[model samples]
Target chain A: MPKLKRTDPDERATDFVESLDRGLRLLQVFGTISGPATLSDLARAADLPRATARRILFTLAHGGFVATDGKLFALTPHVLTLSGSYLRSNQVVTVLQPVLDRIATAAQEISSLALLDGDDVVFVARSSPTRMFSAGLDIGYRLPSFCTSVGRAMLGRLDDAELAARLKAMRREAVTPQTVTDPKKLLAAIIADRAKGYSLVDREAEPHFRSISVPVRRYDGTIVAAINMGAHVDRVPKQELIERFLPLLRDGADDVKNRLL
Target chain B: MPKLKRTDPDERATDFVESLDRGLRLLQVFGTISGPATLSDLARAADLPRATARRILFTLAHGGFVATDGKLFALTPHVLTLSGSYLRSNQVVTVLQPVLDRIATAAQEISSLALLDGDDVVFVARSSPTRMFSAGLDIGYRLPSFCTSVGRAMLGRLDDAELAARLKAMRREAVTPQTVTDPKKLLAAIIADRAKGYSLVDREAEPHFRSISVPVRRYDGTIVAAINMGAHVDRVPKQELIERFLPLLRDGADDVKNRLL
Candidate 1:
């Protein structure tokens, strides 16, 4: 899980910080593996020289972002403040949590808010009625935009060229047996979603997970994010999801766009 | 919002990356605000010069960690990947997620995991089944250690001297009417928690929110983090919380420490 791409300081700006990019690269490598990594493990993962990694780790340790068990290097919980920084600054999730909660409660399902990032949809907030979907989804979990309903909902909001580029970039994988992998088919699905004003997917992301999502609009009507409610296929039939959850998702998105904004 | 504490690169290692520290300070500023910020706003919040802030923002933007609307600079959801890195590497929450889910389902309440960081307790993972207390708490939300049950449960694990140092460093603030601001009394409560094998807090951090917490231990039995179940005071009486919620919490913690680890 070593990162191959690195930011070039001299690429565009005169004062772009190279050291900072390296530091972030160091942080990036940690996500790829589980458990504490040795200095060598980190250097190899981030493609940094051992000495350079040591220096950055030390600096991060000093800054309360990294820690050591006297051998392996690991991140401290203080590093969470960084993401907290992003979440708090946006405050969209925080502002919308009560609303998300209400939606989850009313639907008796897992409701979530996800923002489009690169070719993926990153879950920024989630409200679940149970721990069923809690793994990898306590905010910051990324899912392919090609498969999940929320992903399709946001993709539906993208303009033609951007959507085309994203569709082109995606390496279409069939996450489950029901996942749509063809770019053309995915595009058609997104376009249909645009027409329908929401995206509904059945077992595309994971088997037994069914969801329907709508775009979270901005005051300017731009789709900044998407919201959805998901449940096990057994727990929710498709028609029931639309009848019970669609209005809740649409209203929640409206609340996010108009009231929270 | 500006961070005055900058890690000194020359303190022990000459190669300590100062630019990276500045870059993270750029991130620290994001936590204090509630919305998008201009370049100048970022500089003022992080205490960086306009040019320096602009450069760092450019570096971050290039790295896909930050995004811009051609005017205001803000972090992208990819920053969550950083926290995700930490969470995955530890895998504590990921491994325990199903267990937390079960706890939340069994208790019919919000179950969460928190790790101690400095004077604050940062929630690393959460399995909340309802929206009752979902606002302001996703992964990485920080609560004052003194006024929280999860904090006291971990504090209860600390040795006498470390506990004393923490109490001395704590800037006791009355978060709610029932919050114990006295250092000595807080110490006694923590000791009581240690003896009781759990911490019970009633309407201390948030108004009318009652929570009980128990320490999650490593396989070797040393407390690593704390887990809790929270409910409204009206729904859960303290006696019922201890009688009903405590056993579920202890079992959940035991499962996290022994089964997951």
Candidate 2:
């Protein structure tokens, strides 16, 4: 393996107003890890010098976008203000929330809205009862797009070349015994999902978790995101997911797309 | 009147990398008043040369953060990813969502979380079943801090000098007849809020909206935000807000603080 260069020391001496890039790069650092980070951790994650990282963090902190406990720095609830703008400005989330609420109440399971982020799926909105799951799944969580139903639903909308490129880039590590590691098999599953207009993944990402999903389209008929219903395998059988949950997922996606358009 | 000289133009200019600030400034121009902006409009808002603004807009359009229909540019949902990181990293939101949900369900009204942003209060989280008298009370929306219960709760925690400076900086225009624009009266109200550990604003921000709020503290006892319950003026009387809602608001705020800590 080639040696990985961490930071380019020479770039520090240059004076360029890359503040926009610096600010965005600072956000990307948080995506790489889950917990709060100290100044040194942020500097290393963004591949910037400590002084540079400190300046960006200070500005963000002052803007009420980020918070610090004098020791560790983390993103603040004020960030939702920005995301709230998107939720309100767009018709998708507002229309989808009620439909998702209905599905969660009906199935007594977790339902979510996810969009593709490069090769991963990022959860944008979610609804779940307090006692539904042992490990709570909140918004902003990302998961590999290879072994999930929402991933397949999104993948179903891509053309052949785009699908090939995506499969070529994915690492086919087995997350569970049921996970499909072979590119050929994954492609076949995606093709089937396209035919049915929905997808189901059974214990692929986790042993006891299963999910069913459908693609959500915009007014222009372009697939933009996905809605999925998830439950424990012991509670929901594979056939019940297809028969009972698929319609709710499809209707919710349709409702969201219709309102947004 | 003194001319408002644009502050630190050189420092602000250097804050952009390859004119990325010019690009972000173009995006910020769409907030509140201006929904969609033409090319010339964007150039003026960002104070950049027309060609510079066009180049930045072109790049942003390709990045999917902005959309254009040949004449004007509008924000796309993709832009939220930049701010979404802040929502994901904040433990406060994760703790507060359940509380907001309970309050909204219990009261059958709007429940929200807000933080002090300079002289304004910005909504961070809101749970509402329907639109009431306040039409645009969504997440990320900003309102004058002096006119809101959550704002007053947050202000009550500030030191005397800090609070006085904030009042001096605010515009003294009354939003409604009930709004307390007189500095002395407002100061007394804030003082009373501090003594009682909660705040109530009746028909101050809007004629038919009444709210009660309590300060949310961190584990170290620093007030970081406030939680509020809002109802239509006719549904919840001023006396009932203090009697029925105050204790619940305080309890909910305590629950969120405990969970976050």
Candidate 3:
């Protein structure tokens, strides 16, 4: 019998299957939608032909990642295992959870860790203080990096070319009156924040909310993510925030970096 | 172009791509491990031959779900989108988050929502009171159904045969001295909990931790999940948990069921 040719490095393209890419994209289509989706809805959303979508859905159902009522398809809890694996391997969120807990209570505000993903920042872990309103964010919630404190802090760590490319790529549309949408202004602000070792965005993501963030860095000086404490503007002024909570944010970042080891 | 065969109900076998199946299995292997793993480690853990594992890993890495440092591979935060879509579509956890938050703050304890997955209960959402220790669980942590209050509350809502099969499949060994390991005794306790509209687990998971839980049911009386409040034994005794917190749990459950509509 002939060998599968996987032993040769150049034959990797033959070994790497393309259908798996399509299958994962199918799952992503299901995620972007709001509720249970029909087969045609998924096919259209994923930009795949209906027949291919159906077969992939069948395979997914057989795999336990999905379940359907013979019409509407939704993912099962088993899918969480995929995210669970990521969280477990990353270890930063798990190890720094205690530190985040402390920062929230000590600062009496909501705190979170967010990693830069493309032009968005994804909240990886969060701790909330008891309050009248929520931050309206869950673990996987995303927000444009140019308009958020956590996003800016993470962005401040990138090299000049990367930062310029990402800023050029962003929509740069203002979310609020205070949002910095101009690419040049955003870059100058990021450079300033980097010099100050943190980013403090006031009434940017929301009118009432302000976030103060510090980039979590490895011992080698590479930024891994950002940690922040968010409070209502009326509850805490920007100056008081820097004085009272900045230390906790810095400590949280240090604790997170230590966990990356 | 030749017509794709998905139009025929009998042709699913042709559509189930084997490579996609193996690719998912590889991700599961990463979930099982605690940290970054080598290619051989993943192959052995996933029970796949090294070539298949390498090819699948290549596919996953290209998909941006898996990242490596030339030696060890790990899942990236982007994988959360798979579960994120599930959570977003399910709507139960998102709607009930406020209720869980209110319950946590009102009762001065931690509250979580869990759904039954096979023989285990998986926490889908959680909120914690400002405290020193964590709830020690994240989104997808699983535990045996018979020992924990959330598990037993959901089990209480199940019909006899379903509950019996789940109980029979459980390990049933004591996690703590307080855990009820015998099936008949566990079933009787579940029946008792069902009769009372909630389940109270006293130090079942740990000697110092106690929890009270209630089943979340649809308007049609079909149970969907369980919501629970967990506190330390020294802070809240079992009787006060029943008297003070049981009503809150039921209210939260009712609120959750309304969101199912």
DockQ ranking of the models? 1, 3, 2
Q: After superposition, which runs of candidate 3 have C-alpha atoms over 4 Å from their true positions?
A: A1-12, A132-137, A254-259, B1-15, B132-137, B256-259
Q: Fraction of true contacts reproduced, model 3?
A: 0.43
Tens digits of per-residue lDDT for model 2, A1-261: 111122222222232335656665786577565557877999998999887776676666655555666457776545545445444544455566677667776776668877775567777666653332211124446677889988888987789778977897887678898888889889888988888899889899888999999999877677778999887888888899888889888878776665554
Superior by DockQ: candidate 1 or candidate 3: 1
TM per candidate: 0.88, 0.76, 0.89
Per-residue lDDT of candidate 3, residues A1-261 (tens digit):
111111323336766768798889998887788767788999999999998888888888778777776677777777787777777766667777777778888877778888876688888887766552222227778899999999999998778778888898888878888887888888888989999999999888888899899998866677778889877888788898899999988877776664565
Candidate 2: tens digits of C-alpha lDDT, residues B42-118: 78866788867766666665555656665666666556666556545556666787787677666666678887766
Docking class of 3: acceptable
The complex in candidate 2 yields a DockQ of 0.17
Ten residues in sequence with the least summed lDDT for candidate 3 chain A: A1-10
Instruction: Estimate the lDDT of model 3.
Output: 0.78
User: What is candidate 1's lDDT per residue for A131-182, written digit by digit as tens?
Assistant: 4555444678888889999899888777777777889887788999999888
